[model samples]
Target: DTAFPAVHWVMMGLNPTGSFTPADEAYTMGFEGREAKKEGDMRLLKERAKELGPGGIAKLYMDKLSGTFADGAGGYHSELSLSRDYGILWKYVYGTHRDYILLLTQLFYLASLFMSLYIVINFIKKDISPEAFVIMLFVLGSFFFQMIWEAGTIYSIGIYPYVFALCVLGLNAKKEGEARKEENDDVRKPGFRYGNKSGFFISAAGFIALIAVHLRYPRESVIVSVDQFLFQANDPIALSDGMEIKQSFVSDKDFSIISLKARNFEGQFNDSVYEVSLKDGNGDLIKTNEIYGKDMTDYEFTTMDFENVPGVTDYEISIKKISGENDLIFLYYDTGHTDVYPKGKMTGITGSDTADLTFEVYDKEEPGE
Candidate 1:
């Protein structure tokens, strides 16, 4: 079963295409400097193949397979290598900035994993049937696989039904054992069984407590600052080669930070880079900053700071894509043409003359302000 897929991946590596391959260059290139090395390896392999002729083709295939495996494994290693310094479970939980919802989800998953292991232990000690033991082992394997790989929730959808099935079987077995014990004993204890009313009430009370806590403290708003926007950018405009967007606005106050609503059309690890330039009324450059797509959160306002500029000054902001590989970055714009910033207008956006890029110009408060 696995052999067929293994052979297919090896064959795909020998003749790589943009579609199917043993290794994805984009995934591997997320790490710094790997893109250049991978490209160099490809070039060197092609040159060596030409020099060796027919004999080299065989070696080339093997070489390509080797490169694919090494690169693929290296990407995983780079991710796991960090766990050596920070423990695996710690890194997995806090690898990225996680919100309360995500944190709770991770905690739930950890709890489920531990509970599954506990159930498996009890099943083994109880000398359950071979088929039941095998099923529990499969569930344990799935749980461990998820922990080791740090797979997302979508990956567990298939295994969740099995986990639930095992839970149901374990509960039934416990109830049956209790019934037999009760039949042998004369006196009935005045305590709750595993799935009795008391258990339900306890679970309900815990759930209500969670809800009360959630209601008491709502999730924080995404926009927390009091900074003002020059114009609202409600629509998105994708930037490509030869495309430039310019916005003109008059400063209402002294501001040191300029923010643009930017979004990456690709994954967070994409290598897209964009350039933002600020020019005075006379068209002389005031400041220019380059921001990487990987550094900016998707669909959020990313800011660049500079020396404060006084109010009542006319300025123009230019935004364009500098360089990227197989990714697109979008700068948001206002489609309503409300003329919110009446002092200036937007230009160079495709298909609309009145669209203005969404931007916030403000001064950040210093500490203890």
Candidate 2:
């Protein structure tokens, strides 16, 4: 998983020298000034060596060889014209600035991934109710603010869906708690109207609960699947470029029966495959199987009997296009929109997490079909 390496990088930032340098005398004493330096130099070397374990030393050498730093020689740096003044120079003005940037970005993504995984686990563990699941949908829907993070081009953007899903769970859970409190209170009671003190107090409580859950359990959960499809002239969200379309579902119940259906809008491609996978948060596959698409009729549901799956988070299903330049694939929407949604021209659904529903695929017919 990208997160393991990312997590290792967090330590790298705390002690940049440790990742690529050894804490041992052999490695530390070999530095440029150590041969003739004072005993104090030896002390400093020992301290640095202690901080930069063998892993750090090897990593530092690796980065140095790759030319991650301009002051450093060899490898990727040798190919570049370091003499020029540009973004690269600014990036390298400080020795370990890039590593710091990398560390921050990675930490942010790691946090999001962790949060998303937790929410997913809650769903799988039946820790959340259906109402809370709907709330998760709204939270993820609001997290489209990816445009703000590194212009929405960074790796964190990939993690936003997971974070957004969890946010939905948190926010919805809060809203429901408030609504229930309001219902119990008399309509004539003080501060019962919208935006009143009573509502505010309840809302605050819900928000606090959300935060508490986040902090109390900062552990990992399976990231069943995250799939994004932007409608391009040629590449629609469902139309694959000879790739696979995967989605994740979290189930709280262990069911012996699980099924999948993909809506295809053309002749049988004879090489389509439907796959179901059960995985952990780290993406280690637990169980997986494939169903051929050619066997099923177009626009029909094909059921597959998966083994009794353990109640867990991050169950994934994928459909592969073996050969078709432009095959009609299914697209799903959590909620319906008119103006914003492609409708008949294309099917546009709310791009958010709805844990209660099973993932489905369908073809677009008319503008809103």
Model 2: how far residue 338 lies from native, Å: 12
lDDT of 1 by residue, 203-226 (tens): 568666766775665443221111
RMSD of each: 14.5, 25.8
Q: Give me the displacement of residue 79 in model 2, in angstroms.
A: 63
- lDDT tens digits by residue: candidate 2, 183-292: 89666455435454765567558656756764565433211121122211212245455455545544443334344434454446645554555454456676676656
TM-score of each candidate structure, all chains considered together: 0.39, 0.26
Top model by lDDT, which number?
1
Model 2, residue 266: distance off in Å is 3.1
Which regions of candidate 1 fall more than 4 Å away from where they truly are?
1-122, 143-154, 193-195, 221-241, 244-369
